[model samples]
Target: MTVPVSPRHDETFVLNLGPQHPATHGVLRVKLTMDGEYIVKAEPVLGYIHRMHEKLAEASTFAQFMPNTARMDYLHALAFNHGWALVVEKAAGIEVPERAEYIRVITVELNRIASHLLWWAAFLLDLGGFTPLLYAFDDREKIIDLLERITGSRLTYCYMRFGGVYNDIDDEFIKGTRDFIKRLRGRMPRLYHDLVTHNIILIKRIKDIGIISAEQCRRYGATGPVARGSGIDYDVRKHEPYSVYPEFDFDVPVFNEGDSMARYMVRMHEMEQSMRIIEQALDKLPEGPVMAKVPKVLKPGAGYYYSAVETARGSLGHRLVCNGDKNPYKLKLRSPTFSNLSLYGEVAEGMLLADALALMGSLDLVIPEIDR
Candidate 1:
């Protein structure tokens, strides 16, 4: 319970909640105006890690810009890769092979699980629970290993190409993925939910804290778990129906409470849904060539094209302007975290300092994506 404080306007002090704080997850700083233990205002300071990604996109060719997408959201790089590939394909009128589409779904889902595991570990660490981090990382490593076997990089993967993917998944990769899925399914109920999610302390810390209404989510254009937690059933994969997502049957986890715990629970349930997608994709995996045949110098006819993908964070969109050239005339990236963070100033007002950080953690921000 928050006790009301009667203080003069002059009594407030400014606090910088880090461009270096561990709880921030990356180079993000919140300028907090405080009146005793309560927050007066919270403004997020961005561009500490900006890499000029959009400008780089303009300069590089369609193929050259593929690696740049991975750097924006390092945790779920494949989603960025998919968004770029999709926009290019949409503009160039390239048709992907059936087998490649399944591969894309499988790999992207695995990346989503890895991204969530890291967020889970880090969010628990923010709330002063260290044990969950150990278990989460232990599980995340298995995904990294599986992805590394095919993608060739551990962290920022540039796997997806313009039409399909760069390579194919072998039987060993298939078997490893199935075994990991079974292992995580057996462990989540006991190790994750029982050990952490239903804990009394966690509930107390987040259950009614950082309330974001459904209206506020819409106002801020918040997507993924943040919007779903606030009772918005808008998912790019489902609503827009991209790639092979139409074939899969999975529920978009939603919680109407709209608190920090609600946001946390949405992500927890989403991991299960992602697993379901991967399993279905694997079972229905078609046999054929992975990459599509293309011209030596690619050029989409002069026009504009756009594509959006549901990443671990939220909806990542790629808008491209082509002038019948190999290079994109203009490239605009709409990163979800940028819009999500815009609501912090409104949400953090009057919150306790500790609770505000908890609220920020629940947003699961990746600074590079926002800064880019």
Candidate 2:
């Protein structure tokens, strides 16, 4: 329903787009000012899911805060785990083993694919398609099973440790990943691209709808698919180059359209790139111990340390302040969803209510990360 905006009406109405609505995707409420079916403004109300994550980090030891990272962005918990591990390792001067680095890369890429799959399913659902959700979840289940073999948990994983990962990938896991990669590559063209990407309805609903200029993305600090869709080409893994990511060769997808379809296509292409990375990591998988040698007590020098990783949404960063104590003095998280959602108020204005929801879904928000 791409309803055109009418001239300024004599009256407008206020609508609450739910703290419990499915379209909001979490405990988020958007106070939308509407002129008929056109949105005049959208203000997202947060804090429904806030659990004082940073405060918990300050109160607990460095190791104690590991599980909390997963809870923030439950779908892409591995990226959060990787970011925390990197910051702690940076502060403690810990060098990870070569084999462990490769393992981390493999599992993280797997998690990224799982995240994008979930996003695809949910986004399609938002647009009133149910069959794709079933197909996407059927594929995502394989990734979860593979990760569950090593990580031991399904949704929120604390698999990564300060120097290395909690467990190593076995031969079965390797074979399973390879088989899944082959299966997905074959299905992408028939199941996803031909079925959805080329559909005239989806293209018309998303293409050139809710156009966001590159300058608007910069002003709001939007990253991940949102920024890349606007042709920014800023990926933390490629531009910042952390962990074993530099060792893998992959292309960062960039689309200049700056619309919902552009963002959707960016993620669709990113899943393929992630598969390429996983394949390369498995090919060059080194043989050695997964864990590095380190002391039990982790107390870095009295200073500030920072680390960032490319998560499914965008750049997830952790800033740590230490006083040479077992517990961090201060912990701050830079979650990309917060920055991406911040621009909704500006962009949603004058857009049809349905189109605004499409734009919001394109941002691929995880509310716990923003509320954290």
Please write out the lDDT profile of model 2 over residues 1-372, one tens digit for every residue.
344566465688889998999987899999988998889778999999999999999999898899999999999999999999999999999999999989988888899999999999999899888999999999999999999999999999999998898998899999999999999999999999999999998998889888888999999999999999999999999999999888888999999999999999999999999999999999999999999988888999999999999999999989899999999999999999999999988888889999898888889999999999
Residue 34 in model 1: lDDT: 90
How many residue pairs clash in all the candidates, one count each? 0, 0
Candidate 1 lDDT, 160-206, residue by residue in tens: 98778998999999999999999999999999999999899999999
lDDT of 2: 0.93
lDDT of each: 0.92, 0.93
Task: Quote the positional error of residue 287 for candidate 2 in Å.
Answer: 0.6
Pairs in steric clash, model 2: none
The TM-score that candidate 2 achieves is 0.98
Runs of candidate 2 exceeding 4 Å displacement = 1-10
Q: Which stretches of candidate 1 lie over 4 Å from their true place?
A: 1-7
TM-score of every model versus the real structure: 0.98, 0.98
